[model samples]
Target: VAKPVFMSCNDRQHSLAFGLPGMVERLNHLHIQYTDFDDLGVSHDTIRSKDIDVAMQLGKHANDQLYTFYSASPSGWLMELGWGNYEKPAAQEHYTGDIFGHAVEASGYGLDLEL
Candidate 1:
Protein backbone atom coordinates (compact mmCIF):
# COMPACT_ATOMS: atom_id res chain seq x y z
CA VAL A 1 0.00 0.00 0.00
CA ALA A 2 1.14 3.52 -0.82
CA LYS A 3 1.42 6.05 1.95
CA PRO A 4 -0.57 9.24 1.79
CA VAL A 5 1.45 12.26 0.66
CA PHE A 6 0.82 15.88 1.51
CA MET A 7 2.45 18.39 -0.82
CA SER A 8 2.14 22.14 -1.07
CA CYS A 9 4.01 25.07 -2.50
CA ASN A 10 6.29 27.29 -0.48
CA ASP A 11 4.51 30.38 -1.77
CA ARG A 12 1.24 29.37 -0.13
CA GLN A 13 -0.15 31.80 2.39
CA HIS A 14 -1.43 30.87 5.82
CA SER A 15 -5.01 31.69 4.83
CA LEU A 16 -5.14 29.09 2.06
CA ALA A 17 -6.07 25.62 3.33
CA PHE A 18 -6.76 23.49 0.29
CA GLY A 19 -7.52 19.83 0.85
CA LEU A 20 -6.64 17.20 -1.76
CA PRO A 21 -9.29 18.01 -4.36
CA GLY A 22 -9.02 21.74 -3.85
CA MET A 23 -5.26 21.56 -4.06
CA VAL A 24 -5.48 19.74 -7.35
CA GLU A 25 -8.00 22.26 -8.63
CA ARG A 26 -5.83 25.18 -7.61
CA LEU A 27 -2.82 23.63 -9.28
CA ASN A 28 -4.76 23.01 -12.45
CA HIS A 29 -6.11 26.56 -12.39
CA LEU A 30 -2.55 27.83 -12.16
CA HIS A 31 -1.51 25.70 -15.13
CA ILE A 32 0.77 23.61 -12.95
CA GLN A 33 0.97 19.91 -13.55
CA TYR A 34 1.28 17.52 -10.63
CA THR A 35 1.50 13.74 -10.42
CA ASP A 36 0.72 11.65 -7.37
CA PHE A 37 1.70 8.14 -6.34
CA ASP A 38 -1.30 6.66 -8.13
CA ASP A 39 -0.11 8.33 -11.31
CA LEU A 40 3.35 6.90 -10.80
CA GLY A 41 2.34 3.21 -10.89
CA VAL A 42 0.80 3.01 -7.45
CA SER A 43 -2.48 1.19 -7.74
CA HIS A 44 -5.56 2.99 -6.52
CA ASP A 45 -7.34 1.51 -3.55
CA THR A 46 -10.94 2.48 -2.92
CA ILE A 47 -10.68 1.58 0.71
CA ARG A 48 -7.69 3.40 2.11
CA SER A 49 -6.98 2.66 5.74
CA LYS A 50 -5.44 6.09 6.16
CA ASP A 51 -7.58 8.17 3.88
CA ILE A 52 -7.95 11.60 5.41
CA ASP A 53 -11.52 12.80 5.29
CA VAL A 54 -11.28 16.11 7.13
CA ALA A 55 -9.08 18.83 5.72
CA MET A 56 -6.51 20.52 7.85
CA GLN A 57 -7.48 23.97 8.99
CA LEU A 58 -5.35 27.09 9.32
CA GLY A 59 -4.24 27.25 12.91
CA LYS A 60 -2.84 30.06 15.00
CA HIS A 61 -0.54 29.36 17.86
CA ALA A 62 -1.10 30.67 21.36
CA ASN A 63 1.42 33.42 20.61
CA ASP A 64 -0.93 34.42 17.78
CA GLN A 65 1.88 35.34 15.43
CA LEU A 66 2.65 32.04 13.75
CA TYR A 67 0.12 30.13 11.66
CA THR A 68 0.70 26.58 10.44
CA PHE A 69 -0.70 23.22 9.38
CA TYR A 70 0.48 19.71 10.11
CA SER A 71 0.21 17.04 7.46
CA ALA A 72 1.45 13.50 6.91
CA SER A 73 4.57 12.89 4.87
CA PRO A 74 5.26 10.14 2.38
CA SER A 75 8.28 9.27 4.48
CA GLY A 76 6.05 8.45 7.47
CA TRP A 77 6.67 11.68 9.29
CA LEU A 78 4.52 14.59 10.39
CA MET A 79 5.38 17.62 8.28
CA GLU A 80 4.60 21.18 9.25
CA LEU A 81 4.46 24.25 7.00
CA GLY A 82 3.96 27.67 8.43
CA TRP A 83 3.63 31.29 7.34
CA GLY A 84 2.76 34.82 8.62
CA ASN A 85 5.31 34.61 11.39
CA TYR A 86 7.16 37.59 12.79
CA GLU A 87 10.38 37.95 10.81
CA LYS A 88 12.13 41.22 11.62
CA PRO A 89 11.59 41.32 15.38
CA ALA A 90 10.97 37.98 17.04
CA ALA A 91 7.96 37.43 19.20
CA GLN A 92 8.64 37.80 22.90
CA GLU A 93 6.02 35.51 24.41
CA HIS A 94 6.22 31.76 23.97
CA TYR A 95 3.21 29.46 24.06
CA THR A 96 2.78 25.72 23.90
CA GLY A 97 -0.53 25.04 22.20
CA ASP A 98 -2.70 26.53 19.48
CA ILE A 99 -5.25 29.31 20.00
CA PHE A 100 -7.70 27.73 17.57
CA GLY A 101 -7.84 24.93 14.96
CA HIS A 102 -4.83 22.66 14.17
CA ALA A 103 -6.63 19.65 15.51
CA VAL A 104 -5.07 16.29 14.60
CA GLU A 105 -7.70 14.18 12.86
CA ALA A 106 -5.83 11.00 12.02
CA SER A 107 -6.72 8.31 14.54
CA GLY A 108 -3.46 6.42 14.95
CA TYR A 109 -1.01 8.73 13.22
CA GLY A 110 -2.27 12.02 14.77
CA LEU A 111 -1.96 13.82 11.41
CA ASP A 112 -4.03 14.18 8.24
CA LEU A 113 -1.98 13.39 5.09
CA GLU A 114 -4.32 13.59 2.15
CA LEU A 115 -3.12 16.79 0.52
Candidate 2:
Protein backbone atom coordinates (compact mmCIF):
# COMPACT_ATOMS: atom_id res chain seq x y z
CA VAL A 1 0.00 0.00 0.00
CA ALA A 2 1.13 3.54 -0.68
CA LYS A 3 1.41 6.12 2.07
CA PRO A 4 -1.42 8.64 2.38
CA VAL A 5 -0.76 12.26 1.48
CA PHE A 6 -3.11 15.17 0.95
CA MET A 7 -3.62 18.89 1.42
CA SER A 8 -5.67 20.22 4.27
CA CYS A 9 -7.12 23.65 4.90
CA ASN A 10 -7.03 25.05 8.45
CA ASP A 11 -10.79 25.11 8.53
CA ARG A 12 -11.59 21.45 8.91
CA GLN A 13 -15.32 21.90 8.64
CA HIS A 14 -15.20 23.59 5.28
CA SER A 15 -12.62 21.19 3.97
CA LEU A 16 -14.57 18.17 5.06
CA ALA A 17 -18.03 19.38 4.11
CA PHE A 18 -17.60 21.45 1.00
CA GLY A 19 -14.10 20.80 -0.26
CA LEU A 20 -13.79 17.05 -0.03
CA PRO A 21 -17.38 15.85 -0.19
CA GLY A 22 -18.36 18.29 -2.90
CA MET A 23 -15.44 17.33 -5.08
CA VAL A 24 -16.10 13.67 -4.58
CA GLU A 25 -19.70 14.17 -5.58
CA ARG A 26 -18.62 15.98 -8.71
CA LEU A 27 -16.30 13.17 -9.65
CA ASN A 28 -19.07 10.70 -9.12
CA HIS A 29 -21.55 12.63 -11.18
CA LEU A 30 -19.03 12.98 -13.96
CA HIS A 31 -18.29 9.25 -13.90
CA ILE A 32 -14.69 9.90 -13.03
CA GLN A 33 -12.73 7.09 -11.48
CA TYR A 34 -11.45 7.58 -7.90
CA THR A 35 -9.66 5.68 -5.19
CA ASP A 36 -11.57 4.39 -2.19
CA PHE A 37 -10.82 1.40 0.00
CA ASP A 38 -12.09 2.25 3.45
CA ASP A 39 -15.12 -0.01 3.29
CA LEU A 40 -14.18 -3.63 2.92
CA GLY A 41 -16.35 -5.76 0.62
CA VAL A 42 -17.37 -2.63 -1.20
CA SER A 43 -18.52 -4.22 -4.45
CA HIS A 44 -18.40 -3.13 -8.07
CA ASP A 45 -22.14 -2.59 -8.03
CA THR A 46 -21.77 -0.30 -5.06
CA ILE A 47 -19.21 1.75 -6.90
CA ARG A 48 -21.34 1.90 -10.02
CA SER A 49 -24.36 2.74 -7.93
CA LYS A 50 -22.56 5.91 -6.97
CA ASP A 51 -21.35 6.37 -10.56
CA ILE A 52 -17.68 6.12 -9.53
CA ASP A 53 -14.72 3.87 -10.15
CA VAL A 54 -12.58 2.28 -7.48
CA ALA A 55 -8.83 2.36 -7.78
CA MET A 56 -7.81 0.76 -4.53
CA GLN A 57 -9.24 -1.58 -1.92
CA LEU A 58 -10.22 -0.56 1.57
CA GLY A 59 -7.26 0.07 3.85
CA LYS A 60 -5.99 2.29 6.64
CA HIS A 61 -2.88 4.41 6.45
CA ALA A 62 0.09 3.85 8.68
CA ASN A 63 0.98 7.49 9.22
CA ASP A 64 -2.42 9.10 9.68
CA GLN A 65 -5.92 8.39 10.89
CA LEU A 66 -7.48 8.46 7.40
CA TYR A 67 -9.17 5.24 6.51
CA THR A 68 -9.37 5.54 2.77
CA PHE A 69 -9.47 4.20 -0.76
CA TYR A 70 -7.85 5.45 -3.93
CA SER A 71 -9.51 6.20 -7.29
CA ALA A 72 -8.17 7.01 -10.72
CA SER A 73 -9.42 10.31 -12.04
CA PRO A 74 -10.43 11.08 -15.58
CA SER A 75 -7.11 12.86 -16.03
CA GLY A 76 -5.38 9.69 -14.81
CA TRP A 77 -4.37 11.16 -11.45
CA LEU A 78 -5.34 9.38 -8.28
CA MET A 79 -8.05 10.87 -6.06
CA GLU A 80 -8.16 9.73 -2.48
CA LEU A 81 -11.49 9.13 -0.72
CA GLY A 82 -10.77 9.21 2.95
CA TRP A 83 -12.65 9.48 6.26
CA GLY A 84 -11.18 10.10 9.67
CA ASN A 85 -10.81 12.43 12.59
CA TYR A 86 -7.82 14.36 11.34
CA GLU A 87 -8.58 17.71 12.86
CA LYS A 88 -5.86 19.21 14.98
CA PRO A 89 -6.00 22.04 17.46
CA ALA A 90 -6.98 25.29 15.80
CA ALA A 91 -4.01 27.04 17.38
CA GLN A 92 -1.54 24.61 15.83
CA GLU A 93 -0.53 24.28 12.22
CA HIS A 94 -1.12 20.83 10.80
CA TYR A 95 2.09 19.91 9.08
CA THR A 96 4.27 16.85 8.93
CA GLY A 97 7.83 16.86 7.65
CA ASP A 98 9.11 13.66 6.06
CA ILE A 99 6.90 11.59 8.30
CA PHE A 100 6.51 9.05 5.52
CA GLY A 101 10.18 9.39 4.48
CA HIS A 102 9.42 9.40 0.76
CA ALA A 103 7.24 10.99 -1.86
CA VAL A 104 4.47 9.22 -3.73
CA GLU A 105 5.10 8.68 -7.41
CA ALA A 106 2.65 10.51 -9.63
CA SER A 107 2.84 11.00 -13.38
CA GLY A 108 6.56 11.45 -14.07
CA TYR A 109 7.38 13.25 -10.81
CA GLY A 110 7.23 12.62 -7.10
CA LEU A 111 4.27 14.14 -5.27
CA ASP A 112 5.62 15.80 -2.19
CA LEU A 113 3.44 15.65 0.90
CA GLU A 114 5.57 17.92 3.07
CA LEU A 115 4.35 21.05 1.43
Candidate 3:
Protein backbone atom coordinates (compact mmCIF):
# COMPACT_ATOMS: atom_id res chain seq x y z
CA VAL A 1 0.00 0.00 0.00
CA ALA A 2 1.11 3.53 -0.71
CA LYS A 3 1.59 5.84 2.24
CA PRO A 4 0.63 9.49 1.96
CA VAL A 5 3.14 12.01 3.16
CA PHE A 6 0.45 14.50 4.06
CA MET A 7 -3.31 14.74 3.93
CA SER A 8 -6.15 16.70 5.50
CA CYS A 9 -9.91 17.09 5.29
CA ASN A 10 -10.60 20.75 6.02
CA ASP A 11 -8.96 23.98 4.97
CA ARG A 12 -8.60 25.12 8.59
CA GLN A 13 -6.29 22.24 9.41
CA HIS A 14 -4.07 22.23 6.32
CA SER A 15 -2.59 24.74 3.98
CA LEU A 16 -4.11 25.29 0.58
CA ALA A 17 -1.31 23.31 -0.99
CA PHE A 18 1.85 21.37 -0.27
CA GLY A 19 5.30 22.86 -0.50
CA LEU A 20 7.56 21.83 -3.37
CA PRO A 21 10.18 20.32 -1.11
CA GLY A 22 7.70 18.07 0.66
CA MET A 23 6.18 16.92 -2.59
CA VAL A 24 9.58 16.10 -4.00
CA GLU A 25 10.60 14.18 -0.93
CA ARG A 26 7.41 12.18 -0.75
CA LEU A 27 7.48 11.32 -4.46
CA ASN A 28 11.10 10.30 -4.24
CA HIS A 29 10.48 8.14 -1.22
CA LEU A 30 7.65 6.44 -3.03
CA HIS A 31 9.84 5.85 -6.10
CA ILE A 32 7.51 7.86 -8.29
CA GLN A 33 8.96 9.71 -11.27
CA TYR A 34 7.88 13.11 -12.59
CA THR A 35 9.12 15.94 -14.72
CA ASP A 36 9.23 19.59 -13.88
CA PHE A 37 8.24 22.29 -16.34
CA ASP A 38 7.48 25.95 -16.49
CA ASP A 39 4.30 27.50 -17.79
CA LEU A 40 5.88 27.72 -21.23
CA GLY A 41 6.25 23.93 -21.33
CA VAL A 42 10.00 24.16 -20.95
CA SER A 43 11.68 21.94 -18.41
CA HIS A 44 12.65 23.89 -15.33
CA ASP A 45 14.45 22.36 -12.41
CA THR A 46 13.23 24.68 -9.68
CA ILE A 47 14.84 22.50 -7.06
CA ARG A 48 18.44 21.68 -7.81
CA SER A 49 18.34 18.46 -5.79
CA LYS A 50 15.13 17.04 -7.22
CA ASP A 51 13.64 16.38 -10.66
CA ILE A 52 9.91 16.65 -10.22
CA ASP A 53 7.10 19.15 -10.35
CA VAL A 54 3.40 19.42 -9.96
CA ALA A 55 1.74 17.80 -12.95
CA MET A 56 -1.43 19.83 -12.64
CA GLN A 57 -3.18 22.09 -10.18
CA LEU A 58 -6.96 22.33 -9.96
CA GLY A 59 -7.80 25.01 -7.52
CA LYS A 60 -10.59 24.84 -4.98
CA HIS A 61 -13.98 23.97 -6.41
CA ALA A 62 -17.28 25.46 -5.40
CA ASN A 63 -19.16 22.18 -5.22
CA ASP A 64 -16.90 19.93 -3.15
CA GLN A 65 -14.80 22.69 -1.62
CA LEU A 66 -11.68 20.67 -2.39
CA TYR A 67 -8.33 22.05 -3.44
CA THR A 68 -6.39 19.51 -5.45
CA PHE A 69 -3.32 18.97 -7.59
CA TYR A 70 -1.76 16.20 -9.61
CA SER A 71 1.65 14.57 -9.94
CA ALA A 72 2.89 12.12 -12.51
CA SER A 73 3.38 8.65 -11.15
CA PRO A 74 5.90 6.08 -12.36
CA SER A 75 3.20 4.20 -14.18
CA GLY A 76 2.57 7.11 -16.50
CA TRP A 77 -0.56 7.95 -14.53
CA LEU A 78 -1.33 11.11 -12.72
CA MET A 79 -1.83 10.96 -8.97
CA GLU A 80 -4.17 13.48 -7.38
CA LEU A 81 -3.83 14.78 -3.85
CA GLY A 82 -6.14 17.27 -2.30
CA TRP A 83 -7.31 18.91 0.89
CA GLY A 84 -9.98 21.27 2.20
CA ASN A 85 -12.99 19.13 1.42
CA TYR A 86 -16.31 19.51 3.15
CA GLU A 87 -16.74 16.94 5.93
CA LYS A 88 -20.45 17.45 6.50
CA PRO A 89 -23.12 18.07 3.97
CA ALA A 90 -23.84 21.74 3.88
CA ALA A 91 -27.26 22.78 2.73
CA GLN A 92 -26.88 24.60 -0.56
CA GLU A 93 -28.79 25.03 -3.78
CA HIS A 94 -27.84 22.67 -6.58
CA TYR A 95 -25.22 24.01 -8.92
CA THR A 96 -24.06 22.81 -12.28
CA GLY A 97 -20.35 23.68 -11.99
CA ASP A 98 -17.84 25.42 -9.83
CA ILE A 99 -18.33 29.10 -9.16
CA PHE A 100 -14.59 29.75 -9.57
CA GLY A 101 -11.17 28.17 -9.80
CA HIS A 102 -10.56 24.46 -10.64
CA ALA A 103 -8.93 25.46 -13.85
CA VAL A 104 -6.77 22.73 -15.38
CA GLU A 105 -3.07 23.34 -15.84
CA ALA A 106 -1.24 20.30 -17.05
CA SER A 107 2.52 19.83 -17.36
CA GLY A 108 2.12 18.01 -20.71
CA TYR A 109 4.81 15.61 -19.61
CA GLY A 110 2.75 12.63 -18.67
CA LEU A 111 -0.58 11.32 -20.05
CA ASP A 112 1.06 9.25 -22.75
CA LEU A 113 0.95 5.53 -22.15
CA GLU A 114 -0.58 2.36 -23.59
CA LEU A 115 -3.01 1.02 -21.07
Off by over 4 Å in 1: 1-56, 87-93, 110-115
Tens digit of lDDT per residue, candidate 1, span 1-115? Answer: 2232334364322223222332333311111112343321121122134563322344666653455454444543333444443433234644556678877555333333332
The residue-by-residue lDDT of candidate 2 on 1-115, one tens digit each, is 2233233455332222211221332222111122444342354346547865454444554444445555455664444555555544454445343223223322221222223
* Worst ten in a row by lDDT for model 3: 28-37
| Residue pairs in candidate 1 whose N, alpha carbon or C atoms collide under 3 angstroms | 6-115
Best by TM-score: 1
lDDT of 1 at 1: 24
Give a tens-digit lDDT track for model 3, residues 51-108: 5445544455465565544555565444554445354334564445554553445444
Model 1 clash count equals: 1
- What are the Cα lDDT values of the candidates? 0.39, 0.39, 0.39
TM-score of 1: 0.38
Global lDDT of model 1: 0.39
Candidate 2 to truth, TM: 0.36
Ranked candidates (TM-score, high to low)? 1, 3, 2
